[model samples]
Each structure stands twice: as C-alpha cells, then as structure tokens.
Target chain A: MTEAVLKVENLQTHFFTKAGVVKSVDDVSFEVGRGKIMGLVGESGSGKSVSGFSIMGLVDHPGRVVGGRILFHGRDLVGLPDEEMRKIRGRRIAMIFQDPMMTLNPVLRIDTQMIETIQAHEKVDRETARQRSRDALGQVGIPSPDERLMAYPHQFSGGMRQRVVIALALAVNPKLVIADEPTTALDVTIQAQILYQMQKLVAEQHMGLIWVTHDLSVVAGLADELCVMYAGRIVERGPVGRLIDAPIHPYTKGLIGSVPSRNPRGQPLTQIPGMAPTPIDLPAGCPFRPRCARASDICRTTPETAEHLPGRFARCFHPHLEDAA
Target chain B: MSVFILRRLMQSLVLLCVMTIIVFAGVYAIGNPIDILISPDATQAEYDRAVRALGLDLPLWQQYLVFLSKLVQGDLGKSFVFNEPALTLVFSRLPATLELAFAAMLLSIVIGIPLGLWAGLRPDSVAGRSIMAGSIFGFSLPNFWQGLMLIMVFSVFLQWLPAGGRGPTANFLGINSSLFTAEGWQHLLLPALNLALFKMSLVIRLTRAGVRETLLLDYVKFARAKGLSSRRVIFVHVFKNILIPLVTVIGLELGSVIAFAVVTETIFAWPGIGKLIIDSIFVLDRPVIVAYLIVIVLMFITINLIVDILYSVLDPRVRLADMKS
Candidate 1:
C-alpha cells in the first residue's frame, strides 16, 4: 500500500461556549493513503465536518483543536506555524465545500479566482496561471472553459458552479483533498458526475481524498474506506466493503438498515430511534446508547475502540458477529 | 450595458423633472424671498422694481417655466444675495466641498476598513471590542458637536491647527484647491477629519459586519483549506467579497456625507456648498437654495447610477443581461 498521505489521530476539536464546552470532534482517527479515498460518514451533528475543518486548520473562533496530531507525510500539522501551514495548504492539501457558491466569490470571475488560487501558492506568471485555470475548468468538463472562466458564480447553474469549484480545488493538484459534503447541495445526477470525476482525478493524480458526507449511498461506490462517526467519536471504521457487508457496531447497522433502498419499497424505513445527542450536552458513556437497540449495561462505560475483526475496528461493548448478519 | 445605462438615464430624467417641480413649489411655499430681499420700510415702487428684476412678479407656473428654460440653457438663475449666477457660485464652492468630501472619504476608507477588518476578524478580542465601542461613539455623536469638540481639543487647546475658514487657496489644473499648501491643509484638516469621523465610524461598522459575515462563507474556508496564507485568505478572498457591500455603502454614504457636511462646514466655516447653502437659507436666497437642492438631488441620482454600474462591475450577478426580467 502507498504511504499514508494524511493521518489524523485522537483528534479533538471543542467549541468553548458560554453554556458548556462542545466536543465537536473527539478522539476521531482516520488515515487516507495516497491514491485512495476515505469517506467520513456521520449525521449532521456527528463532527464529520468539524474533523475535516480541524484537518484543514480552518476551525474559527470558539472552536479549537484542543488535542490530536494531524500528520501529513509524517509531519505533524497540529503545532505547525501558520506560515508553514499556509505553505502546505493549497500547495499540498486542498478542500472542497458542500456549497459551491460558498467556495466561490460571487463577485469575482471564475478565471480570476482560479488564477489567484494558483498564484497564491506559486510564483507563476499571469499567462501560465490563466492557462492552468482554463485547463482546470476543462478538466472538470466545463464546455468552453474560456467563456465559463469569464462568467460569475451567479451566471452558472448550481451544477456548473460546483464543477467550477471542483476545478478550483484540483487546480493546485494537492496531495490530499478534504471535501466536506461537496455534492450535498447538488442534484443526484450532478453529484454522481462530480464524484466520478473526483474519483478519477484522485486515481490519475495519485492523491488522497477524505469525502465527508451523511449519505452512505453516495460514498459507498466511491470511497475505498469508511469511518462512521457518532456524536464526536468514530464508532466504526474499516474497508468500505467489509463495513457495508457486516457492520460490527449496532449504530453502523442501524445507519445501513435505515437506507431507503435497503428497505422494501412499500415498507416504512427502519430509522434509528431518537436523534443524535447534541455535542454540548451529551449523555455519558455511549452517545448512541440512548438509540442503540443492542445497547446493554456495559454500554454505560465509554466503549474503547477495539479490533472486532481482522481489519475492522468498532467502539462498542457488544460487537455483532459476521454470522449474525 | 448601453441599454441599461440609457434606461437608467431616462429614469433619472423623469426623476429630475419631478424633483424640480417639488423644489420649485417647496421654495415658493417657504414665503416670498422678496420680503427678505427688500425691507418692509421700502417704497412700493422700489419693491416693484426689485420684484420685477428678480422675476418674482410672475405667476408660479410661469416662473417655473422660466426657471426650467434657464436650467435647460445651463443657467441656474442669479443669486439674489451674491448677485452672481447660482451655478457659478455653486461651481466655485464645489471644488472646496469636493476636496473636503474626497479627503474625508479617503480617510474613512483608509482608516475605517482596516479597523473594521481587524475588529471583525477577532470580534471577541479586547482590541476588537474597543474598536467597536469607538465606532458606536462615532455613530452617536452629532457631527457639529464633534466638529466643535475637535476644534476645542486640536485647535483651541493644542493650537496646532486652525479653528475655521479656508486659510489660503492655490489653483491646481484650473480648479481652486486649498489642499496644496501646508497652511491650507492645516485649515482643511479639522473639517475633513470632523466630516470623516461619522462616515469613518459608519464604514468601520459596515466593514466589520461585512467581514464577519464573509468569514463564515464557504469560499473563505475553502481558501484557507487550500493552504493560502491567512493574509491572502483575508485580503484576497474575504476582502474582495466584502468589498462589494462596502463599495455600495460607501457610494451611497458619499452623497449623504456631502449633504451632512452642512453641519460640519457651518461649524468649521469651510467655504463649501454646505456652508454656502446655510448662508443662503438665512438670507432667503431662493435661487441659490433651489439650485443647491437641485444640484444635491442630481448628485444623488448620478451617484446611484454610478453605484449601479459599479455593482455590475464588481459582481457579475448584477450584470445588464441578468437584470432583464
């Protein structure tokens, strides 16, 4: 296997609010190898997006990475000076946003943004940056890249704008890309196209990608590995196929079971009972305990992440066996 | 683009006609200027002669027609008080007002934007809070009072600057400028600073709010993720986005600044249109008063039109093509 391009260990990002400290990302660990994709899956408040932000060092005020080391090619990014981090950013690592408009300056031309992104990291001439920007747009399958480059974000449809955003992210050809639900706002057809393009680009460029999403179905086909988060913790993680085939954690099973496609067309979906606990005021021990069907007295204590199978790790007192599936 | 401008111009023309009627009617309604022009003790023949010379003997409608005809021919009527063409008087004082307005605008943009950026960037910090507090004071204080206070502190107290009046003037490119000499600048500084104080605070608040809102946007986070330096992210990505709204506010505020300068100019005795208008108001110089109001209204329309064009330039979303229903 290629050396891990990005490795996050025991990451904890907390929001220090007036009421209480919210552990947005707590002890979440994951690794994305070169030329591979890792899907960080969770519900809205599951800290998946926060984890991505922590990795990018983009967490704003009140929320901070209090613990954990983010390793990029064995270099610890946690305490790296802002200057050094900036150098690594855009140049070595990039991120895509859920809303393409969010990733675009509404006032600026697409070409100007892309070229500036290039020029921000590298001292390239205007023509070279412009050429690269044009090429990037074309790579994202934008028809008539030259014309599209001059157009503003509002001029394009949602899908095309997202394509432009993707083009911008890949413009620098960074080693790792942390995409926080980049396709969530896009239509299914466009989402699929973007995913396909991203996967293809990742493979062709030998880059690593961490695609954060709540929808398992979207990443199921694209991500090589899966990390399912509950509240702020990674509850289960393994190869995508293995985790999908026989999810050890009951929460993972519940998530998989709730998928509309997995249920019979006429039947009501099997939703996991109860909502995900708020990060600020979480129930002690297991965050999923209140909702877990297989939860027991042992769940009263925080479940330490342990290897439940040869290659699968799950943070659960009662691990479901392969035969149980 | 031309179509948009032409349409806007036509609308402005209509607005100008309506405004002219209103101004003409309103000025006539405010008691006859002839009463102030000629004393009550004056003989009937003398009064008749004054009235005839001033064209005040004509009916309101006929007087309006005469005024409009002269207006179309680039004559703003003769100032009853100054014994000069109203347009010439306004034009002569226009440079001073423009100079003061531009200087104040420059001060506001230079000082307010950066202060607001800093405050917005770290809103919870001590310095940020202090800046915000200062802006609140800036917004609340009356301009005349502030001007008086500045004069007291910087002029009367310190004796470092002049208290009032345009000290000396020099011709720059055929336009009389009070900013060319040291003594003239000293005279101009207090009024300009006083004028800028209110606008500066407004801009600071605007900038702070804009920056705060913009910081939360997706593109800003994406820019940071791309590993762009904090400087680049804030200045290039965030600043450019915030500039759209800032420019709009600044453009609109400029018209108000000129209008509000009446108070600042009065207190400082600056030889600007604002001061001239006040003097005209006291003596019931109807032509000058009417001309000033008309000029200000025209200025507002021109400024609005310019802002609309700038809006399209800054943000392609507001382009003429997109503006079509």
Candidate 2:
C-alpha cells in the first residue's frame, strides 16, 4: 500500500460558544494515502467541513481542535506553530472551499493570486511564478490562460472561477488537497468537468485528496474510499465500491437507499425518519439512534468501531452482512 | 474604462445641477440676507439701495437665472461683508480647510485601520474589547465637546501642544502645510485628532466588522490551507477583501469631514472653510455662503466620482458590471 499522506487519529474539534460547547467533530479518524481520494460524506452540520478545517488548522475563534493528532506525513500537525504550518500549508496540503469566491479574493487578479500562492512558500521570482500560474490555469482547461490570468475572479463564470481556485490549489504541487464541497455549487456539467480534472490531477501528481461532500453520487465516481459521518462521528468507512454495494451501518444504508437514482422511477423516495441530532445538545450514546431503523437497546450505549469485513469498519450494534440484500 | 468614466461624469453633472438648485432655493427660503446686510439704523432708502446693489430686489426665479449664468462664467459674485469676490474668499480659506481635513483624514486612516485590524482579528480579546469600548465613546461624543476635551488634556493639562490656530506653515508644492513645522503640528494635532476621533471610531467599527466578516469567508480559510503565513492571509487575502467596504466609507467620510469640520474649527479657532462658513452664516454674508455651499456640492460630486472609479479599481466585479451597463 502507498504511504498515508494524512492520518487523523481521534480528532475532536469543539466550539466554545456562549450557549454551549459544540462538539462539531468528535473523535473522528481517517487516513488518506498517496495518490488516493478519501470521500468524507455527511449532511450539513455533520462536522465534515469542521474536520477539514481542524486538519488545516484554520478553525477560528470559539472553534478549536480540542483533541486528536493530525499526522501529515508522520509529523503531528496538532500543535505545530503557525510559522511552520505556513510552510507546510498551500505548499504541501492545499484546500478548496465550497465557494470559489471564498478562495478567490474578488479584488485581486487571478494571476496575482495564483502567483502569490506559489511565491508564498517557494522563493521563486515573479517571472517563474507567473509562468507557473499560467501553466496551472491551462492545466485546468482554461482557454487563453495568459489573458485569463489578467482577469479578476468576477470576470470568470462560476464554473470557470472554481476551475481557477482548483488551479490555485494545484499551483504549488501540494501532496494533499482537502476539498470541502468544491463543486457543490456548480451545475452537473461543470461539476463533472471539475471532478474529472481534480481526479486526473491527483492521480498524475500522486497527491492525496480528501473530498468532503454530502452527495454520495459525487463521491461514488470520484473517491477510492468513503467515510460516512452522522452528527460529528464517522459511522461507516470502507472502500467506496464495497461501502456503496453493501453498507453495514443503518445510516449509511438509509443514505445510499435515499439517492434518487437508486429507486425506480415513479416510486416514493426512501428517507430516514428523524432529523440528524444537533451537535451542541446531543443525546448520549449513538447519534444516529433516533433516525436509525435497526436501532436497539445496545445502541443506547455508544457503539465501538468493529471491523465486520476485510478492511471495512462500521460503528454499530448489528452490522449488515455482505449477503443481506 | 473611459466610457465608464464619461457616463459617471454625466450622472454627476446632472446630480450637481439638481443639488445646486435645492441649495439655492433652500438658502433663500431660510430668510432674506438683506435683513443682516442692512444696518438697523439705516433708512428705507439705504435698505433699497443695498437690496438693489446685491440683486436681492429681483424675483427669486430671475435671481436664480442670473446666479446660474454668472456661475457658468466662473463668477461667484462678491461677498456682502468681505467686499471681495465670494470665490476669492472661499478659495483663500480653502487651503486651511483642505489642510485640516487632509490631516484629520490621514490621522484617522493611519491610526484607525491598524487598530481596527488588530481589534477585528481578536474582537473578544482584552485589547480588542478595550479598543471597541473606546471606539464607542469616540463615536458617541460630540465633536465640539471632544475638541474642547482634547484641548484641555493635550494643550491645557499637558501643555505639550498648542491650543488653537493654524500656527506657522512652510510652503511646499505651492501649498502651505502645518506638518512641516513642530509648532504647526502642535497647533494642528489637537483639532486634527479631535476631527479624527469620530471618523476613527467609524473606521474601527467598519474595519472590525469587515475583518470579522472577511475572516469568516471561505477564501481566508483557503489561504490558510494553502499554508500562506497568517500575516499574508490576513494582510493580502483578508485585507484586500475588507478594503472594498473601507474604501467606500473613507471616500464618503472625506466629504463629511470637510462639511462637518465647523464644530472642531470653531472650538480650535482654526481658520478653515467651516469657520468661514459659520461666520458667514452668522452675519448673513449671502455671496460667501452661497459660494461655499456650491463649492461643497462640487466637492461632494467630485469625491463621489473618485469613489466610483476606486470601486472599479478595487473590485473587478464592479468594473465588469460597469462594462455591462
């Protein structure tokens, strides 16, 4: 197996708010190997984004990585000083946000932003940085890369802007990229294009990628592995194909079953009965128990992560068998 | 770009025309200037003669037409009291007022932005809270009262700076500046600081809010993930985003600073346009008053034009929108 570029162990990120402490990401763990993509699938407020933020050390005030180790290439990133982190961030571990505008400064030219991203880590001169920026834009399939570089974020369409942001992430040849719903806002056509470009880039560069999204459909074709989160914890994780074909956790089953394409046309769509529990005031034991159909008395006590099949893990009292379907 | 500017200039011209009419009508509606111009002991004949000489005897519409025609020819009429062309009197005082307004604006921006940026970064911190609390006081305090208080503290209590006046000035670039001399700066400092306090508070709050808002934006997070130094993230990515709103505020505030310096100038006995206007208002010096109003209206229009241009420069989105229109 390729070496893991990132290994997050028992990570816990909490927000200390006036109302209460929000356990946004509570004791979640995952690993991403070189040239592989890990899909972090969760609904909104499921802490998937927060987990990504914690690893990037970008969590703001009130929200902090309270526990866990973020191992980047075997080095613990948990308490790394900002100066050191600056050297490692963008240069080795880049992140793409849900909104391209979030990554693109509306006022700055695309070239300036991309070139500066390069110069920020490496001691490259303006000419070399500019050339690299142009190449990165071209790699992302932007036509007339030279002219596009001179344009600002606003000059490009939403899809093109996201492509620019993707280019910026890849500009420094990062070993790991954490993309938090980078293509969620785009239409299907643009989404496919960006996803294809991202997959191609990661494979070619042998870079590890963590693609966080709520849509399983998106991850199905893109990621090598899948981690399904409920509330703040990972419920099920396995190789993407196996997890989709036979989900062990009830929540995972519910999620996969609910996909519109999974059901026959003219049939009622499947949905989990209850709402996902709020993170701030969560019930003890399993978070998905309220919404889970197979929940039992054993679920009232927190389920331990148990390997049910080869290299597949699920936190559940009753794991689904491979032949259950 | 030139087309955009031309379009905006045309709009400004229309706005200026409308503003001049309102101001002309508004001033005339307040009361007759002839009441103050004519001495209490003067006979009816003397009053008639004075009214005729000042063209106050003409109908309001005719008076406006005559005034407009003269204005078109670069004639601002004569000051009833100063016995010189009203434009000359206003222009003579323009240097002093411009000096004060510029100094105050410079002081506000230089001190306010950094403090605001600091306070904004950690708004809940001890220093940030204190700065915010101070800003509230700055915002709430009356300019006249604040000017007096500053004089009492820095000039009377400390005796470190002068109490009032423009003090000694040195000529550079054909403009006399108090900043060139120690005594002039001392004299200028109290009023400039007084003038700046309210605006400084505004800038602080704006910057704090802007920083807070921009920090929450995804781009800032992406920048951090890119492993750019926190300084670069805050300064380059975050600062540029916040500056859009800041520029708008600064441009608008410049006009207000010039218009509202009356109180500070009065307290400090600074011989700026505000002081001149106040004096003109008291004695009903119609020509000077009218000229000052017209000039202020022109200044506002010009400032607004600059701001619009700056908006395009700072944000390419604005430029694109302009191009579309």
Candidate 3:
C-alpha cells in the first residue's frame, strides 16, 4: 500500500454533557492509504460516526476532541486552529452524510449549492465555478446535468438527491472522503448503483475513503479493510476477507453471525446478548465482555490491541484463533 | 405557474367575501351608529330623518345587501365623520401606515437576524448570553410601556429624537410621504423603533432557534467537511435553512404592524390608519369601520398569498411537482 493519506493515532473525542463525559471515540486509530476503502462497522452510539466527524472537525459543542493526534499526511490536526483546519476540509478531505434528503440546503437551487461549494475553497468566477459544478453532476452519472443543476434539491428523487450530494462532494477534487453510511437510506438497486459509482470514482481519483456503516454486507463487498467499533473503541481491525472469515473479537463474530443469511431459516435470527452501552460510564475493560461467551477473569482488565496474524489486530485476551484454523 | 396563481386568487376572492360578512356583522353588533351620528338635542323628526337617510332604519341583513351592491359598483360609501369616500379615507392613510410598517420591518430584520445568528452560533459566549437575555426583555415588556420607555430614553432623557408627530414630508402616491425626506426620518425613527421592538425580538428568537437547530443538521456538518469557512456555513447554509421560518413569521408580523399599530401610532401621534380606525370605531362610523377592516383583510390575504408562493420558492419539497415526482 502507498503512504497513508490519513492516519488517526490514539484519537480521543469526548462529549462533556450535563450527565458526564461521554467517550464517544476513545483511543481510536486507523490508516487509510491512497485509493483504499476502509469500513468502520458499528452499532448506533458505538462511536463510528463520531470518528468520522472527528476527522472532519465537525464535532459540535459539548463534544470535543480531548486527546490523540490525527496525522493527515504528516500534519497533526488534533489542535490545529479552526482557520487552518478550514483549508484542508472540503479541499483535501470531504464527507458524505447518511441522509441525502437532509444533506442539501432545501431552499437553494442545486446549481447554487454546487457552485458555492466549489467557490468556497477556490477564488474563481461564478461562470467557471458553475461550469465545474455542471461537469461534476455529469461525472456522478446525473442525466441532463444542465436542467438538474438549475432545479432545487426536492425536484430530484431520493436516489437522485444522493447522487447530487455525491457530485457536490467530488466537485472540488478532494483527496479523501469519510462517507457516513452514504447508501444506507437508498433503495437496494440505488444502493448498488451508488456503491458501483463510488468504487469507480475512488479508483479514478486515487482518493482514500472511510465508509462508516453497520451493515456487514456493504463493507464486505466494497471495503478492502474493516474496523469494527464497540463502545467507543475498536475491537478488531484487518483486511475485510480475513476479519470476516476469521473474526478474532467476539463482537465482530456476533455482528457477522447476526446477518440473516448466515443463520439457518425457520429459526430465530442470531442476536447479540445485550444492547450497546452508552458512552458515559462504560466498563473499565472491554465494553463487550458482558456479552461474550469467552469472557474470563483476565477479561476484567483492559486488553491492548495486538496483532494475531499479519496485518490483523484484535483487542482481546481470548482471541478466536481456532476459528481461523 | 399561472394556474397556481389563478387558484390562489380564486381562494382569496372567497376569503375576501367571508371576511366582509364577518366584519360587517360583527361591527353592527357593537352598537347603533345612528346614536353617535345624531345629536341628542335634535327633535324626534330630525332623529327619524337622519336614521332613515343613513339606512339605519333597515334591518342588518338588508343594510349589508345595500353595502354589497354599492361595493360591487366600486363605491365603498362616504364616511359620515370625514365626509369623504371611506375607501379613499383608508387608502390615503395607507401610505403613512405602509411607510411606518416598512421602516419597522427593515429595523426588525436588519437587527434581529444578525443578533439572532450571533446568539445561536456562540450561545455560551458572554455577548451571546447577554443578547439572549436582551431578547427575553424584548418578549416580556408590554408594547405600550416599551414605547413609552423608548420615548423617555431617546426623547425625554437623551433628547435625541422627537417625542411625537409626522415631520416635513414629500408627495408619494399623491399624498404626503415622510419616507422621502430626511427630517421626516427623524420623526419616523422613534415611532418605528417603538413599533419594531416586539417583532425584532420575535425575529431574533426565531432566527436564533433556527440557527441553533440547523447548525446541528447533517448538511451543516457536511458543509464544514467540505472545508467551507465558518462564514459560508453560517450565512449561506444555516441562514437559508432558517429563512423559511423567518419569512413565515415576518409575513405575519408585517400584516400586524400595518393593520394594528394602534399603540405606537397613538404614542408618537403618527398620521397612520391605526389612529383613523380607532377614531372611526369610537364614533361608530360603520362605513369607515367596514372599509378599514376590508382593506386590512385584503392586506392579510395578499401577504399570506405571497408567503405561500415563497414557501414553494424556498423549499422545493413543498411544491406540487416535487411532491408528485
């Protein structure tokens, strides 16, 4: 793999709510090399989305990055000034949200939305910006880009809106993009089309992507690597094939087992034993220990992330080595 | 588009008819206009002649039929007090009322939106907190008392502006318009400010709430991710989202200011419709009351129709084609 475009090192993002400090993303670390697609798999509130937001510096008030370094191409972004951070955002690293319906400004024309995005980073004439915006819509497979550009967001169908949003993201030629479940709200056929377009776009642009989602099948098909998050920490990280076929962490295994096709018909679907823990007052050790069959006294103490195989890491005392064999 | 407008116009005509009926019946129920019109010292013969000439001798339904017939023929009847066409009386005062309304709205929008945006964006800042506290005062104070206090500060204490009455004026719409002259603005300033206070606060609160809420939406975060400056995010993205609600409230507020600015006009002795209507009500001049109310209804209908069109323009999702497709 080429030099990583983004390397998040022991990053900690906490939400200081009235209740307490919520460790939304605690010591989360990963690397996305150029042209690579990494999936961040987790249940809701497991901090996968927060991790994506942290990278973009899009975390709102009461939620802040508390510790760790986010090294983007060797520049530490953890404590960078807002103005400096603004330069890298959208220009170098862009994001796609979960809901396309809510992502575009409802009142603005599609052309206005796209043109402003391009002009936000670069000092260009409106016509030039508009032309580039038009080209981007075309690039994203939107038909008759001219008319669509003039239309408002609501004029488009659900799938078409998502495509426009993607076009908006790609308009500036960003080097990396953190897509937070971009295809989750789309129809099955639309999802496939979006995924195909995204895969093609990534390869064509040589851009790194971090696909944050809970659906194992989506990442399994699209991502080269996967990081499974549990209670604000990564439980397992490896190449997609290796992690799916031989999940070292019990949480990853449970997630994989919970997929309907993996479970036999005419029976209750495989289920995780407990709900995902709230970020505040998480367990001292592995957050998933209570739900694991292999939990032991040693599991009472926190386990460090360790390599179980070449390029495969898991934070567990009782790694499922036998599953691989 | 023309069909939509035609449908709206048809709906408005029905509304106007209903409004006229309600106002006419409601005003008739208030008291006998004849008692106020006739002198108590006059003999019985004089009283009967006055009542019959004015159509007070007829039943309420029959009088309304007479009014409807005259109204269709473009005659709104002459004011018994002013001895001018009641429609003309109301319309002459209209320019003055409109000038004051426009000034108040301009002040409301210009001050309210920016202050509200600041308060919402930096809610925890010292200035932001103070701005919010100030808005609370704006909401809490009685309009009459607030107007008096402003007079005390600017007129009585500071002696910065006039306490009452219209100043040097220029002709507009073939009537005296204070808006066209500089000294006219000085006289307008205090009254317009007094009138603007409540609406300004409302706009501030509404805009602040919108900014607070919209700042958290997925689109806002996505815009930041694209590396757009905070200014772009706030002004372009956040401002546009909030505008839909702002437009709605401002439209209603504009109608209220134009029609029911009795307190401010009375306090400053401004020559506007509010004073005219109040005098007509006191004298029980049915023609003037009915004409004034009809004009108010038309104004409200026009504003509401504009708001409907703006709704489609602002948010495409609410439009017919968007909803259908």
Candidate number with greatest DockQ: 2
What's the iRMSD of model 3? Answer: 1.4
Backbone clash total, candidate 3: 3
Best-first order by DockQ: 2, 3, 1
Name every residue pair that clashes in candidate 3.
Answer: A89-B227, A90-B226, A90-B227
Which lDDT values do the candidates have, in the order given? 0.87, 0.88, 0.89
TM-score, one value per model: 0.94, 0.93, 0.94
When 1 and 3 are scored with lDDT, the better candidate is: 3
Model 3: per-residue Cα lDDT over B152-240, one tens digit each: 99989999998999888898778678888888999999899888888888998999899999988878877777778788888888887
* Candidate 1: tens digits of C-alpha lDDT, residues B1-325: 7887788778878887898888788778888888887889999999999999999899999998998898899888999987999988888888888888988999999999999999999899999999999999988998778888999999988999989998788888886787888788999888889989888998999989989898888777776776666787788788877888888899998998887688888888888888888888877787888788878888998898788887777766676744641
For residues A1-325, what per-residue lDDT tens digits would candidate 3 score against the true structure? 7799999999999999999999999899999999999999999999999999899887877899999989999999888998998888888888999999989877789998888888888999999999999999999899999888889877899899999989999999998999999999999999999999999999999999999998999999999999999999999999999899889888898899889887779878878898777678887788888888999988889999999878989999998888674
Which should have the higher lDDT, number 2 or number 3? 3
Q: Is the docking of candidate 1 incorrect, acceptable, medium or high quality?
A: medium
- In angstroms, the error of model 1 at B308 is 2.0
Cα-based RMSD of the predictions, in order? 2.3, 2.6, 2.6
lDDT of 1 by residue, A1-325 (tens): 4699998999999999999999999998889999999999999999998898888777877899999899999999997888888888778888888887567877677887888889888999999999999999999899999988888888898889888888888898899988889899999899889989998999899999999999999889999999999999999999998798788899999999889888888999888888888788998899899998888888889999998777789999988885534
The runs of at least 3 residues in candidate 2 whose Cα sits more than 4 Å from the true structure, single-residue gaps closed, are A322-325, B1-35, B38-48, B320-325
TM-score of chain B of each: 0.95, 0.94, 0.95
